[model samples]
Target: MRFVAMCSAPAPLDQAAIRVRHTLMLLALLWDADRARVDLAHELRLSRSATGNIVNELLAAGLVQEVGQREDGSVGRRATLLRLKACAAALLAVDLGASHARMDLLDLRCRTLGTRTVAHDITRGPGATYSLLAGLLEQLLLETRIDRSQIALLGIGVPGPVDHDTGCVVQPPNMPGWDSENIAAELGRLVALPVLVDNDANLGALAESRFGAHAGLSDLIYIKVATGIGAGILLGGQLHRGVRGGAGEIGHISINEQGPVGRSGNPGSLESYAAAQVVPALAAQLRATGLQTRLPDPASLQDLLTHAAHDPLARAVWETTGHHVGVAVSTVLNLFNPQAVVIGGRLALAGEVFLDAVRASAVGRTMHINAARAHIALGTLGAEVGVLGAGAMMVDHLLTPRGLPLLYSIARRAGQPVAEATPLAQDAASRAPPAVSAVYTPHPSPPRSHPYSPRRNT
Candidate 1:
């Protein structure tokens, strides 16, 4: 299931402060570069006096800094330029995969200060995995000379489904012995910080939505085709995790009834056909059929892509796999009608030969109305996407209205408590939006068996 990290809104009496803080943080984040108080006031649609009050509070809290002044052409007055203190705090991001893990230390602006990748196995279970990650995190802190107290939060991207609220791995097919393991709590204990967990693909989607090729789009999908297949869905400018956080398990969708079964015990699943594991297996199957080719008998997806330049058989396999993936994507297009479909992961490294095939097939199969509107493209973030996404998710959560209070609480723990301030003006308070909770919570039952058939909430 997909995990979100923000809590539901509190009572109306408490919302004014939350809304004012939330708006200030969002403006600071999106503005990225230095902006003027007048611009922030205009963007937030608040009076100059109100905007200045919020800015003053953020400045007092060490969240924002005024750097120099904006010299407009007019001779009237120079506007002071304000920007977020990008280095004020740090975040820890972990991308846990089936065969490897990537850890990164990022500043408040989600800029990487240090990163390291290590080979590991998730099937080794949570204890071993958590220990390995903790060690890696400690190493990073040492290398970067970042104090433990400087870390504000932790974001983790697991290959398997997670119980977002509890940070538990929930009956993941690829990760044995991980079921019901409270990953967040365990890691939080080690690092002494609140932790957020989510599917790796979902994190990738979030990263791409905020900073990658599809940065401005609200409706998009990120499909990661690696050792396994997964999709990250963004709809209506927000991540849609479904009722149970299983909203984007397109890999389990059956395409060929006679094809090989997947970990979900489903035959002809998309993952069984398009994942990195499938390339080698499909090669072996082709070789057994006495197919003449320069491609190795059992080749990695990388090896096949290299040979595809000279081997018709290797190119054919990629083409066929891409077509199969496209069929699944076509179904997604028909359903979600996203503005864009971004293809990522190891297999996507095969380049246009593979992407072209996916696009051609998906366009051919999808209805013209949906197909015409969706732009298919490759992901731009490369190997760092997952970690960046995780970091971005954490940052986004911490900047929310409810998250602001949590941030203050974290600051208190860090021995840098921010002083309380008066609430916003009555009219501004009345205009505050209701709280929308996105934080993960425990599910009532264990994750359902795959191929999971979600009941569509109409």
Candidate 2:
């Protein structure tokens, strides 16, 4: 059930063909044109001829086109190329981080058209965050002059655990008023479009895989070390959104029982010692030990981190912080044999100091095998990642297992009785498909062979 991309092009057939062409062209670019088709065929296990046939079908469907030629050092005529047209489809994206929210307009090519950010503490007063988002989105669309109907999908990336299926944010130990918020339903109603949501770390991992440092890699982990720490895990080339979507809370791993009790009541979680808030107090304690330091007054955790990088005592504080972070990350390394581990967020900005301890602790504690494939580095996406991630989250949801809005559309058709609809839905369900399957699953049992008639199968 492919979406027919709406085109502004005048020629009807050409318009549809161009839309399909653009979509496939974009995918080829993402897949790396030189190697992708071959890889795709290999992955799909289609022989050259069969693959060529499918490519022809895609061309016929207006989803793709042969654009150029590729030479694999063969003697005869080279293989023709395929690529997608980028402007045929569009998506909507939102990123809700601890400090702010950002909205973006994206095309099917994964190219960004417009973006707007509402800068405010998301953990602030009740309704402040969502209210800010409501206005921000309105202003962005207005400013960009983009039509609403052009947006076919909406994606959001929240700062904390989200029920992957429902897009609801679970109670964040740090953000007090966010629990019970029905993000999906509310946003769905606001935009009149399909809404998809996931946690920020997961989105960061997605960003890395789709468009950043870990691009083309099969197994990678994206770690963001903000006020709190988290990990975005990618296993076998896909995100592992654990049961309830709350799987990436690496900050909650208990590192010190004797340290101050953290938000979730776990004594000495990784966050307690490594979070921005705790660094200053630890620096202050270092000062009390008769060590001269510049960290005299700590207003923001970032301030302490800045001093720690230069001042000896502050460096010591970071060393300790890194140790704690390392302990927690070591556990993760042991558990996940990832190809890369990306460190991000405010804490990661501490650069080498923070990473050294994490690396030392991890290497010392983890088995050789666990640490073998892992490569630790900072995030390459920077601040834009959160928003980009938010946008990407929606795009991923729309493109993944959860297919399109066909069922909903089928339901809305006038005079289509429920009895008549059951068979259509079941037939669609029985032929399980990838990506789309993530979006919707039909009834497990056969539709009553006839909805209005007595069932004969039973």
Candidate 3:
């Protein structure tokens, strides 16, 4: 009986095991440096054979490549070094702000190969936006000289609250015509690609945490102060999206009940005072007072920052703007006690003057313990943060336990045969590994009105 049982073919690998192996391998490469087969095996605490199987599958999927031999001054044969194939698959990241649309073509390593930004009003609605995006995508491909077939995924960051599960923008105050629009479905139809959407501030937070100067900090807050103010909250290394995905709508948080109302109909909101739009008007008011300063009449946000150091009037305006932002940030610090508060967005370009005022006001108002622990700083990625964040999010999703099958499917489409290319894929259904006993069930995306069909020009 024992011999018969031992000789019987094993069951197929369950969803859990496939995901575990794929995620472990991808994440191990993502963080580690100059990995070899032996290094991964030790890192994952898996047997050499199991690790090799996972590495082989990754290689077949074109997600990783054997770079060169590791030089550890070994006695005999040196192990081949393995690294993520940055050019294995292309990803497009779009950052749609209230007044600008920015697109970046990134490789699997999240390195930007080409980037373009165009001025466009979001209030024009989704149809116009999609058309513009399609043109931009074509232009990006042409500029980078990359074939569209190599593209794997598209990620978008919008200036609004997003229902991530459905990729819909929900009642965003800045985006007048985009309320409740299914961004992913509409945009996916235009480009014929798998699309993921998230709030711009959320992406900024993710970018700062993963790729900024303070990379790897688990708990951080990314505050975006632009045409509108918002925050992305990361607690314990995960996004703390509220029940309705409105957790970081800090712009609407009321500082004074009697203050003037803004777009969101929130009285005394942070956005009402400190948004980038307010800077121009505020500067106008100061100039009207005949305050002798180098600032131009009706100064732009850029002008304000340019003269902030030398001009007294510019300093006053920034001080005021930063104070408003800082007051709101103080509340966040006290409530969340994050490790760092990273300021980003268009207005953050003001640099030290803006950051100093924010730090002063926030630290002054925050509770002693919270103030002591939280370090407020400017973001390092600049205007590219949103797109980078979106790319990072997509990468993370594709490596999740539920995402391995989709990744494998994408790899298969890119020319690798799942059954023949991967070691266990051939007889996985009948030769399940001993550790993979759980049942596997795939949850496909809901059928779309406009199903994905590559829209590439031959």
Q: Compared with the true structure, what per-residue lDDT tens digits does model 1 show for residues 1-458?
A: 11122333434637575555445444433334467888877765778987888888777766667888887788877998886655556778898888999888877556677788999988898878888988898898787777777777889988777765456777887788988888788888876788888888888887777667566566889999888788988875567777656778888889888888997799999988888877877777777877788765567777887776567777777787889999999999999999999999888887788888999999999999899989998898888788878877776667554456655545445545322212111221121111111223233333211111111111
lDDT by residue (tens digit), candidate 2, 1-458: 11111112233546445434333323433323323356546644556665566566545544355667886797987766665423334556787767777776655444556677767787784366656766776786686565555556677777778765555678877667888676777777766776766777887886665555555555777877776677888776556767667787988888777877876788888887777667777877877788776555642566666665688886787788788878877788888878788887778777788789889988899999999768877777777677556544544333321232422222233322122111111232111111111121111111111001111110
Winner by lDDT between candidate 3 and candidate 1:
3
lDDT per model, in order?
0.72, 0.60, 0.73
How high is each candidate's TM-score?
A: 0.85, 0.74, 0.85
lDDT of 2 at 27: 40
- Tens-place lDDT per residue, model 3, 290-325, is 778876676778888777777888888888889889
After superposition of all CA atoms, the RMSD between model 2 and the true structure is: 12.2
Better of 1 and 2 by lDDT: 1
Model 1 earns a TM-score of 0.85
